[model samples]
Target: MNNPNALASQSFDLAAQQHPHLLRSASYNYPHRCAFKAVDDGDTQTVNQRLSISPLAIWLNLPARRFDTALGRDFLDSLIAEITLRKEAFGRRPVTQLLLRHPFLHYQGADITELMHLLASNFRLNHRDNSPIEYCAELLLEEAEGANLALLKGLGFNEFLLSLPASPSRGDYEKLHAIWQHAREFAADSLGVRLPYGYPEQDLHSMRALLDQILSLKPDRILLTPASELDRWNLQDHIHEHGSNSASQFALIYNALRHAGYRVLGNDCFVIGRDSLAIAQNQNRLRRTAIAYNSVNAADLLGLGPAASSQLGSRYESNLEAIQPYIENLQLHKLAIDKVLQLGTKAKACRVVADQLLCYHRLDIHYIENRYELALASLAENISWEFNAEANMELMRIHNGLLQLSDDGIMRLLFISDTFLAGLLKTPKKD
Candidate 1:
């Protein structure tokens, strides 16, 4: 219950006072070491931690035990209300397509639509909502005649997923089947499904079987992700747990997509032919965001909620996660920011280059040069040497300032490690 505003600063002071060099980016605050119960996985801890996410995504995630809590619900209401009241300040939509923690909601005595509407508090989602923009390709395209055309996509104009229950019951699957059977009629502009890993009795056969069931829906795209969003979540292991290498696992998914006549899109996203994303990729115009591929720049993101993040200009900031602190700050009309990292020139330059590698899998050295006067020799003597220590040395190289990743290097940056990326980002020199 300390001032959430200073929590990030205090933690920074503590880390600097102790072990500053072990860290890399000062702006990238590690959540575990922040204001909450870092050591425990209790309800408050998780809620406090997760509530740090944007309100849309937070509601998607139901708390572990408490299905209903007056304070939590009220807090969530306030969060949305505040966002709704202030549009000019943030310049983000209140009715954005919220990421629902699908598998967590209970429907014993609740209407999913009503519950979703209540939670969102800012948008309208009907069975027939028709979005103005296309969403994720993971969904099977809708070709029905005026069926459910009122279900519009929300603020984040991405795919709408029926987050499968973590522990699905007969009823769950039945409900899911009913929805999927007529999902196309939902008038969804674009639809996608997120298939999560880490299920009971996980094996290749089970994976394939579950995948088969999902693919049978013919979603526009199939995005495979980890059920648990842990920082150390091993997606490769989830794909083929039999001690498979990254290359082998990559081939597994790549080949599977080919077998299904589906094209392997960037990251883990797979797309059917003629999908908008595929077209965008074909034209080299697609840009990836947390919500999936879009034309919006990732650097322009402004997050809200406890520990919600915002990356504006050359600075990054995140709110404090504790509910009391967040609510208190909002009541005081102050941004619930606990940490801020103002990026230096080199950091920004490196970020642009790194983001290219991350999102596009290639570096536009010319773009970096036009933006900043970064020298090729400085890049080699300093940046190159620094990265080589952390990244795969064999894949590390800086040829005339046009940094390119080998297939192995791209795989490393894309699939497994951010070690090379971390070294590229400059840490703040403590005063």
Candidate 2:
């Protein structure tokens, strides 16, 4: 067999050179093309839009700046208003998961603990049904040390997710290990680690070493992300020139992890075989954003705080990333929506197919035929023919009434998804 790592590297370089967008599907926002718009408070139709589907998860993105009591309360009030509106519209199906991102950076000691309590209390009172909710917090490794873990656990934040540096020092690993032990003591339900690859210093060797260190602690799930061109996490001097070969390097790390018995799914997420993400993938219920979730049925996402985005049914809405505007709009009893995309029939179908291939690694022909009312047999035939060509690398194949992707195909999911999207776009819309 051809060396898997070599195949990944070759395919990755070609993807970068010719199919850059396809390679970019590895990023969280996969098929979404955001079109921003100014918020008009007078637009009642837009402002009054509510969640059409019961949200499975609620994401609270804390501002990077320190938290203020008055401002924080206003934010919470705005969140409550939004939830109330969704409940009124969709009826309370109850959100099963709540993820609070960058919480520790915003507050400390009693203040942070108090904020968590308030958030947990308000969310429970407003959104709870018979199902018990899972409360999760995503924060930096450094912040984990000083965070009031005991209080957070009491507030029902059972899951803790931390992002480590691209190149962690010995001290960093030690600190993480210490935090891991403490989290277990607090009865933390699950701990996930997000590790970024493609930094100037990271190669296959370095990444494997890093994986060894992290695996020793045995995080419930591991996410490997490409280092952003801009240092979003404030990693200081570790930020350097990110080369164009980062994707190729990421592919190498991915192949290495797979050979080591790690179940690396989608593009960059690695987990044990029994991890929820893996199970969700097998069950064909994995949904993706910045995080992955199991959506047994249709699932919506409600995002709060500055710069957040929500996927509510066929519509995608984003809040103003600017703190002042987000705060002022909410203060005026307005949803701080800065952009909206109402998915058309074609776009929605494209997303469904893309999600199936990217997350589940297979596309059910009958499922698409039944759901979209579009004949994909012709599309499948075309894909098979073209994929058989040398240039296309045969990344995908047709099995018994199913179109399944090889690992290489998953790496180029956006490309394959785009191909299907092109076919959908060509089809005449039903009158």
Candidate 3:
């Protein structure tokens, strides 16, 4: 791909095939490969060597689908086993974040509390801390009762990202408003609202109303996500049509939020401009993820639970997706990994540069060239970037060996980042 415009005009499926690693997401991280493997003592030794590179930040992700079935004793035992493995693998490495996604939808209230305490104890995380773990709960708004929020806060979750239904009812609005007030009273650090757009049923007016209600609460952040549920059945004609018009919707929301003195941070997140994430963005410390921000730069992520992904050094892997196999593996005291992708030296360099661009919207060109031993200047000279201010308002520029993105460039970060990604992924000519 030459530029953002070129990427926009190409066949998405074809581009994805060509650069699956680069095009994983326009804004999120996803593993590019999944290769099944058996877990045993040999695997354990491999894991131990990789994990010895410690002080990696921990992100415990509990995906909701596994809990859809009634919370059984076996599942609890699986949870204990996984936690034990995590603790033993990376001993005393503090968990910086916990993501409990929509657990309230399936489990009973008491069960939720029990699970929280279990995690808290094993993970060495509690409700109160001078250096608190970012415990974010992504719950359906309908399930975000005052009681639920209170329980979460009591269990060490400082952040809340509530998901709104495509077309929420008046009662839903009222409940969300009440929950916002409860969040304030309970001293929650951040309360974010997320709405999944790109469905035919949702109109701009209703979206506006939802944004208005969310803004009235003075939320810390607002996110707009694309709803791709229809894609499963190959009924994406409406989704595609609406997805195009959704750009206008985004322009409307972006303008409205900016007018209201809010900062449009990153692609889809709008912040009120004073919270930790917003501050992190200003200080260039913000690292955006699917659910939240990482304040620190360069921390490895270790994910636990069913289908969780991990990024440790040059290694990227995931737990078994099937709960039965995952639980069974842990029951047998083995690693529940389903796939592993060990990055090549070139791929690692590309990933690091891509991460810097995504995280900070600029690349320290000198730092990268020296560290990776790459001829970036000659490589950059051969590649054409969108640098004309007249055509695209100076989308990207390289001056004095510093590669930077303009505001418009940052808006098209995925494509811009992919340009360098493609270059780095190319096989080097042998001497």
Better of 1 and 2 by lDDT: 2
What range of 10 consecutive residues in model 1 has the weakest lDDT sum? 23-32
Model 1: lDDT of residue 211: 61
Q: Residue 132 error for model 3, in Å?
A: 4.1
Q: How well does candidate 2 match the true structure in TM-score terms? A: 0.79
| Per-residue lDDT of candidate 3, residues 56-97 (tens digit) | 445555554434367576766786678777665565555666
What is the C-alpha local distance difference test score of candidate 3? Answer: 0.63
Per-residue lDDT for 217-305 in model 1, tens only?
Answer: 77777665544242234534433442233233334544565578775444456677777656666676655433344432222344556
What C-alpha lDDT values do all the predictions have?
A: 0.44, 0.63, 0.63
Q: In model 3, where do residues sit more than 4 Å from their true spots?
A: 1-25, 29-60, 63-71, 126-128, 229-242, 288-292, 296-298, 378-384, 387-391, 427-431
Worst 10 residues of 2 by lDDT: 34-43
Indicate the residue-level lDDT of 426 in model 1: 27
By the TM-score metric, which is better: model 1 or model 2?
2
- Write one digit per residue (lDDT tens) for candidate 2, span 251-281: 6667666776776566667777766667777
